[model samples]
Target chain A: MTEVLSGLPAALGVESLLAMLAGTLAGIAVGAIPGLTATLAMALLLPFTYTMDPLQSLGMMAGIYNGAMYGGAIPAILARIPGTPSAVATVFDGFPLAQSGRAKFALHVALVSSAAGSFLSAVALMLLAPPLVEFALQFGPAEYFWVAVFGLTSVSLLLAGAPAKGLASALIGIAIGLVGMDMITGAERLVFGVRHVAGGIDLAVLLTGLFAVPPALAMLSATGKHAEGLGMTGPGIKVRQALGFARTWLRSGLIGVTVGVMPGAGGNFAGILGYSEEKRAARDDSMFGKGDPRGVAASECANNADNASSLIPTLALGVPGNSVAALMMGAMLIQGLNPGPALFSQHGDVVYGFMWQMLFTALLMLTLGFAGAKVFVHMLRIPSALLAPMILVVCLLGTYASTNSLGDIWLMLAFGGLAFMLSRAGYPIAPIVLGAILGPMAESSFRQALLISQGDPLRFVSSPISVVLVIAIVTVATLPLGRILWRRLRARDARRAEHPPPLRKDR
Target chain B: MSTPPYHGAQVGAGERLLVHAAVAALGGAVLWDSFSQQGASAYFPTAIGCGLILLSAVSALKVVPRRLLTSEATLVKGLGGLALLAVFALLAGEAGFLSTALLFIPAMALLGGDRNVPRVALATVSFVALAYVVFHVVFAQSFPPEFILGGR
Candidate 1:
C-alpha cells in the first residue's frame, strides 16, 4: 500500500497527466474513426512509449483504453457505423436516436453510462484483482493449459457464426504462430530460410493490417454517399434525466458488468444483452429500436462496463478476455511489466498506479466525450475518398515503426489482402484476429503440458482445472451442433404436424 | 433487368481450384519440413498443415454452390492493389523511404480508383515528407538510403 502511494506522485505527475490527456483525446479521435480501433490506436502509440517512463506509458495506454471504448459510441451514434466492434450494439439505437435529431441526448447517455461503467469496473479491478491473482497463483502448467483452452474455446464458440470456420481460423493462427524459432529449442521450425521470418510476425503489425487496413480498403470500395447532417438540436437530456434512465435500468448495468467479466464474452455481447433486457422490462418497449434514450443508456453502460471488466481476467490470469485486453497485455509486456499473478507481487506499484490512472482517465473521458460530441459528429462529414488513403499511410508508417523492417511491411500487406479476401467470403474477421492473439499462448502451453505428461494424452485431464477445461472445450465445441440438431428436430416436428393426414393414411 | 443466378459461377470455380491447389502445396511443404524436424515440432505443424488443407478444401467446396466473385471491379482493383503493394515492398529497400513512398502512395490511390491526380500527388508528397522527418530527423533512426535515386 505504501509502495502504491509512493508511486502515485510519479504516476500522476504533470507530464504523465498531460500525456494521459493527450492519449485520451487521441484515443477518442482514433476510436471514433471507422476502421481505426482501440487496438490499432494502442499499437500505433506503443512505439512512441518506448522512451517514456513506464508508469507514464501505462497511464497513457490506460487512458487510451478507457477513452477509445467511449469514443466508439461517437461514430455509432452519428454515422450508424460502429467505430469499434464493441460498439456494434450501440448502433442499434444510437444511430436511430441521432436520426431523430436527438444526437446530443444519445451522446449524453453514452457519456454518463460510460463513466458509470468505467468507475464501477475500476473499483472492481482495484478490489478484486489482488485476491484473484492470489487464487490463480495455484495454477500449474496443466491448469494454465486448461485456462488457455477454455479461453480459446469460449471465444471461438460464442463469437464465430460458423463453428468450423472459427476452429479452422484458429488452427491457421496457431500454425502462423509456429513460424518462428522454437522457444525450447533454438532451431527454426518453419522460417523457410528467411531471416526476417525467424522473429515471426509481430502481433501489432498483423492486427493493424488485418483489422485496420482491409476495412479501410473495403470502405474505399463502398460507394454509398450519405452526408452526415447531425446537429446538436434536440431536447438536451440533463444529467438528472440520464440518471433517471440509469436508475430504471440498473439491472441492465449489472447484467453488463456480469457479462463483461465472463471469459470470451465482450462489450458487444453485454450491450446486446443489456439492451434486450431493458427493452423487455420497459413499460414503453416500442420506444426501443426507434430511438430511445434508455436504449442508448443500457447499451452504452453495458459496453463500457464490459470494456473495463474484461481486463479482470487478463490482469489476474494472464489470459486476455478479448482483443483489446490482449493488446493491453502486449503494451504491458513492451513496458517490461509481466502479467499474471506475479505482476501484482513484483509490480504492485505499477499495477495499482494503473488502476488509479484508469479511474481518473474514465472521468477525463466523460468530460472530453461530451464536449467533443459535436466535433466527432462533424468528423463524419470527411469524405471516405480522402480518409481511406490517409489511413493506409498511417498503417504503413505504424507497421514500419514496429520493426523498421521492410519484410514486416510486406507481411502486413499480405495479411491485409488475405483478410480482405476472407471478409468478402463472409468469414468473420474477429475469430482470425482473436486466434492470432491467443494462438501462441495456446500452442506453447499445450506443448509444455504434453512434455510434462511425456506425450500422454490423458494427462490433459489429470488436474481438476484441466478436467473442467476439457469439459468446457467439449461443451463449447458441441453446443452449436446441439442447437442445429434441435432446430432440425423442431422443423421435422412442424412438418409432421402439417402433414397429419398423409401420416394417418400411411399408418 | 435481373441478372443470371450463376453469373459468377465460373469465377467461383476458378477460385476454389486455385485455393485448393495452394492449400495442397502448402500442406505438403509443411509436412515435409515438419517431418525433418527433431521432435514434437513435427507433430504440431503436420497437424496444423493437414487442418489447413482440410479447411481450405471445405471452404472451396462451400463456395462452389455460390458466387465467388462478388464484383469484377473489386477483383481487378484488389489484384492491382496487391501488385502495387508488391512493387512497393520490392522498391522500399532500394528506393528507400521517400522515393518509394512517393511512388507507392499515388499508385495505390490511383489503383484504388481515385481520379483526383493533384490530390493524390499532394497526399503522397506530404506523407513522404512527414515520414522522413519523423523517422529520419526526429528519431534519428537510419533507414536504407536510396540506391536507385542515387542518394546516400
Candidate 2:
C-alpha cells in the first residue's frame, strides 16, 4: 500500500493525467456510440500508444477500459441498444425503463454503481495482487479449463426461460471462436480459406456487426412509425436511492472481481452473472424484465468491477484474462516491461503507477460519468431518423479504422444481417459472444491439461482446486432447476392450504 | 423455456423445432469439420459441437413461434440502411473519409427520414468536420486508408 502511495506523484504528472482523462472521455464517447465497443476503443488506442511513454500509455488504456465499461450503459439505458458486449444484459431492463421514461434514475443508478464497483475492484487489485497471483500460479491447464467452464456454466443458465436457445447461442459462439489458427497445433479449423477470417474474427468487428448494425437497421425501420428517443424526464438525482444500492453494488463488484481474476472469463460473464442473480433474487420477477433500476445496478456495477479485476491475472501471472487485457499486454511488451513477479521487483514504480492509476482512473470515471450524464441524456432528444444514420456511419468508420480493411466492413454488414435474423427468431445473442471469447481458452486448457497428464482424464479430478471447480460448475448448472423446483413446491403447498385437493373425478 | 409464440404460430409444444433443427445442422457442420482437425486442437471444437448438437436437440422441444421473423417494413428498412452503408464503405477508400462522410451522412439522414435538408446538411457537415478534427487533427492517431486521397 505504501509503495502504491509513493508512486502517486509520478502518476499524477501532467502527461499521465492528461492521457488518462482524454482516454477516459474518448472511451466513454466511443463506447456510448451504438457500434463502438470497449474492445474497438482499446484496439484503436494500441497503435496510438506507440508514441507515449509506458506509464502514460498504460494509464490511458486503463482509463479507456474503465470509461468504456460505463459508457456502454448509456445507450443501453436510453436506446435499448448496448454500446458494448458487456452491456448486453443491461439491455434486458435498461431499455424497458427508458421506454417508461425513467432514464434519469436508471442512468444515476448505473453511474453510481459503476463507480462503486470499479473502485472496490481497483482496491482489490492493490491489496490482493500478490496473494491472488500466487494462487493463480497454481492453476495448470486443467484448472484454467474448468475455470472457463465454471464461467460458462453460470452464464449458460442466465436465460432460464430459454436454456436451449442459450445453449445454442453459446455453441455458436464457440464455433466462431474456433475460427483462425488452432492454439495447440497451429492448424486452421473454420476459416474456410479466407485471409480475413483465417486471421481470426476480430471481436470488435463481430460486436459492431452483431450489436450496432441491427440496431441501426431497427431505428431506420421504425422511422416515423412511432415516437422514440424522446427526451428523458430529469427527475434529478437521489441520495437515498444511491445509499440503498450500496449493498447490491458491493456484492456485484465482488462477483466481478472473483470471476475476473480467473483467466479467460471477462466482463461479459460478470454482466450475465450479476444480472441473472439479481433477477432471481428480486421479489417481483415481473418488475425485473420490465426495467428495474436494480437490474441496471447489477450489470453496470459488475462489468466495471471486471474492468479492474480482469487485470489481476494479467499483471500477476502474465496471462491475459480477455482480449482487452491482451491489448494491455501488447502495450507492456511494447514498453519492454515484462509482466510477472519480476515486474514488481524490477519496475516497482511503473507497477505501482499502473495500480494507483487504476484507482485514480476509476474516480475519474465517476466524476466524468456523473458530470457528463446530463449532457449525454440529451442524445435521447435527437430524432432517431437523423441519429440512426449517424450512428451507422460512426460504427462503419470505427470498424474500418480499427483494421483499415473493406473486408472487415463487409463482414460487419453480413454478420449484422445474420444477427438481425437470429434475434428475430428469438435466439439469445450473448451466448454467441461468450462462446467466441471463452471457447478457445476452455479448449486449449482442456487439451493441454490432458497432454500434461499424458491423456489421463483423471488428472482433472486429481487436483483439489479442479475438483472444487468441477463441483462449482455442477452447483451453478443445477441452481436454476433447483430454484424452479423449490418454487413449485412452495406454490403447491400454498394451493393446498388455500383449498383441499379436488375430489377425484371418478369418485 | 417458455417462449411465447411470436408474430403468431400460437401453440406451444414444437413451435421452435424447426429453428432447433436448423441450428442442429449448423452445429453438425461444426462438429464434422472439427473431426478433421489435428488431435489437441480439435479437442475443444469437437466438444463444443457435440454440446451444441445435444442442446439443440433439447431445444427442439420448446418451440413457440411468435412474430414473423422480420417485419416487411423492418426488412426493407434494415436493407435500405445496409445498402447506404455499403455505398459509404465502397466510396470511403476512393473519396477519403471526410468527403465520403460528408456525402454519406446527408444521404443516410435522408434515407432515415429527415426531410429538412438544411438540418441534415448541418448535422452532416458538423459531424464530419468534428470527427476529422478529433481523429486526424488532434491525436493524429487514427487514419483509415483512401485510394483517391493517396492514403495507401
All predictions: root-mean-square deviation over Cα? 4.4, 7.0
DockQ of each: 0.27, 0.33
Best by lDDT: 2
Q: What is the TM-score of each predicted model, taking all chains together?
A: 0.88, 0.72
DockQ of 1: 0.27
Residue-pair clashes per candidate: 0, 10
Off by over 4 Å in 1: A1-10, A46-52, A224-227, A430-437, A450-458, A493-507, B1-25, B68-73, B116-138, B145-152
Q: Which segments of candidate 2 are over 4 A away from where they belong?
A: A2-15, A26-117, A159-161, A221-354, A366-374, A487-499, A502-507, B1-22, B68-76, B94-98, B134-152
lDDT of each candidate versus the true structure: 0.71, 0.73
lDDT of 1: 0.71
Question: Considering every candidate listed, which one attains the maximal DockQ?
Answer: 2
- How many clashes (backbone atoms < 3 Å, residues ≥3 apart in a chain or on different chains) does model 2 have? 10
Colliding residue pairs in candidate 1: none
Minimal lDDT window, size 10, model 1 chain A:
A220-229
In model 2, what lDDT does residue A270 have? Answer: 94
